[model samples]
Target chain A: MNAELPRRAWLRQNAAAVAGLVFGGAATAATRRAASPHRLVWQIDPKKCVQCGRCMTNCVLVPSAVKCVHNFDQCGYCRLCFGYFDPGATELTTAAENQMCPTGAIRRRFIEPPYYEYSIVEDLCTGCGKCVKGCTTFGNGSLQLQILHHRCVQCNECAIARRCPAQAIHRVPVEHAYRMKSQAASVTATWRHKEDGPAHA
Target chain B: MPKRSRIWAWSWTLVVAASVLVASGVQRFPKPDFRSGYTVPQYTPPAVERTAAREWLDVGLLTGGLVLAGYFALARRSRRGLWILSVASLVWFGLVRKGCVCPVGSIQNVVLGLVSPADGIPWTVAGIFLLPLVAALVVGRVFCAGVCPLGAIQDLVIFRWRPLPLWLRQFLGMIPPTYLAFAVANVAVGAGFWICRYDPFVGLFRRSGPAGLIALGWILLLIGTVVPRPYCRFLCPYGVLLGWCSQLSRRHLTISPDQCIQCRLCEESCPFDAIRVPTPPHPDRAAARRRMVYALVLAPAWVVLGAVAGWAAADPLAAKVHPDCALAAELRTEESTGKKEQSWETRVFRASGRPLEQAEEADRDARRRLRRAWAWAGAWVGGVFAVRRIALGRRSELADYVPDRGQCLSCGRCFAYCPREYVRLGELDGIRGQP
Candidate 1:
């Protein structure tokens, strides 16, 4: 009976060894099947963002990693840029009172008679999404917010993503990290998928 | 070529193919006809995307740290080396990275990946997750001793501690497995990664967060000064798995360099209460046999009862936690009350143009998934309890005091406390130990 006990223990040890090997093999198989060279990081889907302004305040960084980026292709370049100017502003002058951005991040440049170019000065942008709300409402929604990877001390789980009412923030492969305003049409449809690369890259 | 090599080759081919699929992401639009020679500048995103290099670096650092921690605990037998490594780990993995690239949170990715293969885990996360487990399987939890930032932070803060009473320690030991079950279940149900959501030290690492959570972190740290690694011992889900692997370790850290000298100092020094003194096998073989039989018999019953309990509680739990379920509940209340002022969630749902039927359908699906996940989780927890019971039932012979293989963090604190260890280290002369 004592000899049998040792034998049984030996068998148990071997079984455990086999189980560990099987687990390792299965994990390796899964990794091989995945074959993903890219890492996953959090980003906002522009289509899903509700302009709740949580990105402005909820980020761990002091000034927030989220910044406004213009999709120039989608820009209307309107003489009256809704994103750059406040609706309540009595005059059309480029005054601090008339500017929509809290920090005056948007710079309006004249291109032609009816075309006024708008660009985002990222450092000044607070990612407040006030301009985003105005632009989405009145313009082509060209001025949208994106998480700048430079400033983003990429947390495993983003603080803003937890409270995002839109549930817009999600993990995407590094290639799809920049879900900017222009890629809005195509990015959300396929970005989350691991097997497929982004629509363009 | 062997089958394994062929498989590897095939995977590499697929990887190359995937990379080839990458195309220029630049999208251009027709310019507004301007008489002025105003050419639109090429679009360039302000910040470069964080490369895979950094994530790979994290994997390398983690591996190196674990190896060094094991060396310090075993070969060098230096607690000072472990402490210095702990501080370094706290600075790098804890503060510099802002608590990302963590093995503890990687369990969620693994769960999520397996649950939904479409959402496969990143290769780096898989590496990070498996490394510590593999290390633990080979040697006792060297990762926990000085490498894990969470443990390191707590360990560094430990000024002095009083070991909890055995009864309290055993009772509190139940918490980690329960925490693990829920955390795994939550991810399996696709609810969310609650571990990352509720990380205690994330606020401290980031240095800016909600005031309440930061205060809670500080409170835990204060408690940590009097209780060594309260989180690791009683709460960490990863620790439960590490403990199991550690229990089955091929090699484990020894209290003494050569052999124990029957000194009580090591026991006095150990804050974690992981030391076990020598004991003879139980005298009554019949009683021991009966207890073991009872434990084996009750294990199935425990699993069944757990599953039933889990199934019963699933709906109520999901309502409180699951986003879809919460949203549905909120929407129903708003409609029934005819409330005009809508919450942010309700406003978002209404604006989504998703019909109430569709939303309710999603909620039902989430609830069903949650129930299934809970049942599996419950069964796993029950199995763990059964294993614990069986271990407790067993009677074993030991010749000397030793660190409990399952609970020991391999921190090397007990080494100095052992008089024999001093003899081995040549601090005390004329004692023959391992040359």
Candidate 2:
């Protein structure tokens, strides 16, 4: 029983120390939470994106968070796509020289003799904006870059956002994460058509 | 053929057959044929994305694990509870999470964030990195006890306890600090995440990645069967930070619940050899003081030497950080040899219409940053070594066996072995009862 006295004292001392540590930890956690903006996460607006290729290099992750997303509704289903074919292509073949994407991310398929369909092979896309730039310049802006939310760790201040020349990236509600141009354009078109009809009458 | 030679020959044949089986199993999917007209293969990208909800779940698991580890190690003192927690952590963190956003690899992220404020870190990453460290400072290395998947995997595989030689262990212990220094320096200069790149077990968890790393993981596990957390002890750069926190921990794991009877029954219970035996009184205090003074005097010189070494290696280290630097060098070589072909990276650089001088300028800038960072890292490494040497040289008096606070993982293995603890838990009667 005599040996227990010092041990109990030690325990009491340690308990106080533990209490202090817990209090300190709680205070720090509280302050960090207060300092951070918690509810929102960064996303890229497809229409606003100029495809400057900053997303490829400026992202903190080795593979950038920005990936090419196909909006089939916006696509014209052209036989010769600006996004798929090289400007100086000799033949409309699936040859390496005829491809526009530096990584061959755009895959071309033959639907019939004179028609073909194009889709983005995401794994190969480097977010270089080369294909997006081509498509936006010549064809309907069907192929666009979007932040793959799954790949994004949602940094408090995104690295790519800071470097984006067009200021395309912005924080959006998690519930409405994706900011696709096709959906926005269609909504605007219907509103425009209704406004035009009233004006004509 | 001799019996041994014949056996070796049969084993080689069996290994070849096993490799073929494994390869065939891995490639069970039908190969795509481009020649038979273009049929667009439905590309199903691997679902390895982190959602906000999933990130929260990981954070929740980490926080819960820390609390449970502390309770098991300190309050309950249940080795069984710790074992269960370890296994659960292995499944959750190792297998389910697939070893990404781990505390071990997060050290690089935190370092990178600190160095380059532009590369802002995720709050979740920051929280995951700091949580265990704060926990360690309060409750010793309870994080290592059952919370860390790396430590848990190693702890589970431990069967035969074979302690390394004192000199060898001490020498190997120095590796973590050096590793920590290099990882920080590399990241500070925008070098790739070396820790994640070389993670031995991540490949095993994902069941894909480079084969060489998988082989290394298996080898490490094989060694861990006897060595008891070889990575945690000798390699993990994060452990260096944890050890420092544990050293100043408020309330660490104790071998006895009530009193140390000095029975020494729990002496060999620790698989990691973290138990400190009772030390005799210092023979000569004056001599010890002189030795400490000498060590203090030599510490600066050691720092300078380390700085010089780091500065010298800065050029090579800088090359690793900027891909453009390596590409430029390769392009120059190809140009001098009159080779018309250009690599993909060089082609991309040229196609971008950026001046070659710009790439050179970036390389130079990266090298300058690397030199400064490497020098500081070297000095830090030197300081660590000096402190370690002094710590080793110093002698302390101990009345009873206690867990070495810095080295002890707070695993609670010794608690079950302690007679006093057994009695306190009512597992043993006070008089003439076998514990």
Candidate 3:
């Protein structure tokens, strides 16, 4: 082919071949070296959350995938629950004005004398972490934010993770999806969080 | 620093830390004693719904798109076929998936994997990233023509040809490579993924995001109505890599089936301004040789100059982009002022009980790495463009107008405008087949 064409054309063709090898070769090598067996998705470690409320706004989803979660085992179940009631509130009722949660997402119910259970309304929970801040400061750190796997689009680099000042968001394996509190701690033992009980959704 | 204030800040931080740690482990009010009959309800949050099978399916669909795009561009030479395939790709990849594991964003994943010890790139993601480059090397930019959702979305809005002056086009062309260099550097230094952070079209695809990003997307699409795939030409980091392989394509797309007839219609037809007008043989071989020689000799100086400029930007980039460096700077301020800002990071750090020196040391290491990565990437960008200029100035053997291999996306748009193509398609009767 080169014998039929001028010298410059022949040289240019060969240069193209050489350029292909260099660029394609390097890209191919990078791709091969980058392979992994495990699939990973973005998650937030409940233990590391500082309740800065960045999770509420930083998510690409309109209403962020980050939601307020309750760890039932760790809850003190107190009637004067700090997560549900504002610090200055005179009444411990579920009145909107006295609620620590801006969206009124936390519901309080009487389970026993002086023992009340708190549950989060996922739709209304803005993940503001206002309640999380109150809970961590005044009560047991049972209320924390976790990235819901079902709603998470799983961006290559999670938008919320990048801005999370606490740096709690991390990539975890798909099997261990939610970093939820899973164990029932004994009275003498420290609270343990791991995959336990029938918690699959 | 005053001793009292220093002691005050330290004690305050420690007290909060102690309370938080104790709060996590110990219940303030006892969980009902063993004698009580209360049962704690189990609260399980949502689990992963999308499965491994979708990844395989994504890879398969991408491969099918690439194969179909190549066939439409090269074998069939039908612009209509290409557009149909492109719209389908945009719906599936852009609208339905809403942009995950895309080739454009995967560049960050590749660099992040190289820098960090986190699980290497997922096999599905690697395939998504590498498949296009492979196609470009074998054929030419088959990905850009119809397969890439980014290109497709931009392709939809382009209604007119508003070609910029040659000088401005040449100047703007350098952006993609420079953007690529900075994106890689940002990832290497533990800066957030700037590519995903500022992807102009993500807001449009997902139908919601920060107003600024959504506005940017709309503005680009508005400009694209006349400017024609502005992101593809000027901003896409991955397109720079595609251009490299496309230039060396084994079987390049030809604007004409047989020979260029000097008709100049293809040049008028292309919105991308990718068609190169014929350049007659040079009168002075010596002058041309001298010009090429000057570019080759001064290439190192261009690279060094670029590196120096990039090094200047590296300091601020490290402080602002990387999370740890920002934290370290905040810590330094607190140590000097003896007043805490109540930032989340500091509270968490104090509670974790890690020494301040360790964090400061990590920040120092991060800044140095970021600087070197920026400088090296800048140098590479400089060298690549210098070589590109030299190549652009060189002589071509053909006397007829031809497609620029590096720039032409091979979208098959020009195929309809060529008179020779009309004859090939049997739409014109004057010319039967090429003699």
Candidate 4:
């Protein structure tokens, strides 16, 4: 009887592990069967966004935690990015007080002539209509929150879908969840320069 | 009567069936096995509609049933008119509003937001404090006996009539006050509400959230099976607050000596230990008066001293990564005008401030000393208040046990434990049936 006790304890512990394994296998099978095309909620047509601040406000989250991410290669290195400053700009100061939008969504980086790399700090983004509207109105749709698929809860039927006005958001195949645009030829040349030739090209 | 029993049995069967279905629902729509996948709550504003009905039911029943049971017990000891009034008030405040000032949810919210400051005060807290106060003043601590959400949960469980070791309960009780102090200080600093973050049972009832918290809930629920509502007893700040309020509350759960069947039944039945026999050879008026004076003088002083001591004691830790500490760092950072300060304050503040500055190490030493002095002062104040309570006279000789809502997390054990209430309301009234 004493000898049997150890065996019984082992079974008790392993029972959960075994059940988990079985359940996991079944869940995986179900997931495969349930899989429909993958979808991306956020997309940036950097050229189209007018920086109107619509995305900042209309979003459900309080802080709107979504901010613009810049793909340097895709950028035109424009001197006046709608993403950065208001059209009626007086001075190009980096101080938060002097920004186009009320909240400072744009972070400017100095690179070369007439071209500065700009990025969005997301947590501060209120999803107000200003930035998105601005970007869509002026420059390339460079600024948009692509609903970072990983961050999304992936509710089987998206909640935001019912509310989206433009209906610009669509479900893309999961395998190609995000569609990142390659830079223009000139920008591509710059990108390849370092990789192919001079170390710091 | 037979029909009532039949109805009860049928309802119980249905409840069991529903519980089984709901529990199994987790199994059917098998969530992703990935540790992070289905379990972890990604950062998102919690949606109100997302709250599952089962969870809401559990929360409502737990808070409602226990308070109701306590009321019934206490009512038996009081005048019939007083009892009726108390019951009506309880129904209006506790059950009608669904235990809004539910100590359980409020305490949990406070804990959850402690690390994150942006969170707002949950509405349920307003209900928990207000309902009980209104009830106690008008009807007496009927909320404490039968209607409080947390008390209901505890009363419903705690099956074995074993006495917890005094030293053990005392040691455990210390945790809630410390938690209370931590919550109050953090809230004052605009740090994330500490009360809501780590609530074990709220997570359990909700059935989904961040994996870490959900796991903690399950552990607590399992613990509840053996130890009663451990969170309500040990770590709830709201319970601590209510316990104090109940102490001062005029319309308390009073037992009449005329009903004198000194059966000791109520004493044994009460899980909260609110009921106690009056100690013999009570202190004379002079002694009582002296004690009351001491209580009045020492209580506020102790609170201040305790606050200071607690603050000073934990300053070094608080200075780092505390949300409030971040505010101070921001101030110092601006004062330096980008110039590096080598002071001790700089070091303590550096870690908390945004856009980390390397020179602020100097501020740490001075800050630590000041905070320590403050903490010592606070401890003395708090220590005195605790002492004065012992000196004060006992009001109720035999009372029904219900958790203090200020510290309780509204877990459903008390409601489960009150057998008489369970019989009256049926098990579904106490149990959060599946589905």
The candidate that wins on DockQ is 3
Q: Which clashing pairs does model 2 show? A: none
Q: For candidate 3, give the lDDT of residue B159.
A: 86
Fnat by candidate, in order: 0.29, 0.02, 0.50, 0.00
- Per residue, candidate 3 scores C-alpha lDDT tens digits across B251-286 of 767788767777777678889988888777889989
Model 2 spans > 4 angstroms off: A1-69, A80-201, B1-49, B282-289, B431-435
lDDT of 1 by residue, B307-397 (tens): 8887878988887878889889888888899993288888998877888888799899999989988888888877887888898878766
Q: Residue-wise lDDT of candidate 3 within A1-201, one digit each (tens)?
A: 112256755776687777656644544454444333457778787666788888998888979989999988778776678888999897877778888988889987676677777999999998888988888777776887888878889887788888776777877667666675332223112111111211121
Per-candidate Cα lDDT values, in order, are: 0.79, 0.74, 0.80, 0.45
lDDT for each residue of candidate 4 in B78-189, tens digit (9 for 90 to 100): 2333334445534544344433224544443333233222222223332333444444333344554455434444444555545566567767777777777655554444
Return the interface RMSD of the candidates, in order shown, one decimal each: 5.0, 13.8, 6.6, 24.9
Error of 4 at B232 (Å): 1.8
Winner by DockQ between candidate 3 and candidate 2? 3
Runs of candidate 1 with Cα error greater than 4 angstroms are: A1-16, A22-26, A29-37, A109-116, A188-201, B1-32, B280-294, B431-435
TM-score of chain A of each: 0.79, 0.72, 0.75, 0.57
CAPRI rating of model 3: acceptable
Give the alpha carbon lDDT tens digit for every residue of B206-262 in model 2: 665457877998899999999899999999998887887787677778999877888
- For model 4, the DockQ equals 0.02
Residue-level lDDT of model 1, residues A118-197, one tens digit each, is 88898899999999988877666777788888888777668888779998887776777788756654766665444454
Better of 1 and 4 by lDDT: 1
lDDT of 4 by residue, A94-122 (tens): 66555665667667765544445566666
| Residue A147 miss distance in model 1 (angstroms) | 1.3
Lowest summed lDDT across 10 adjacent residues in model 1 chain A is found at A192-201
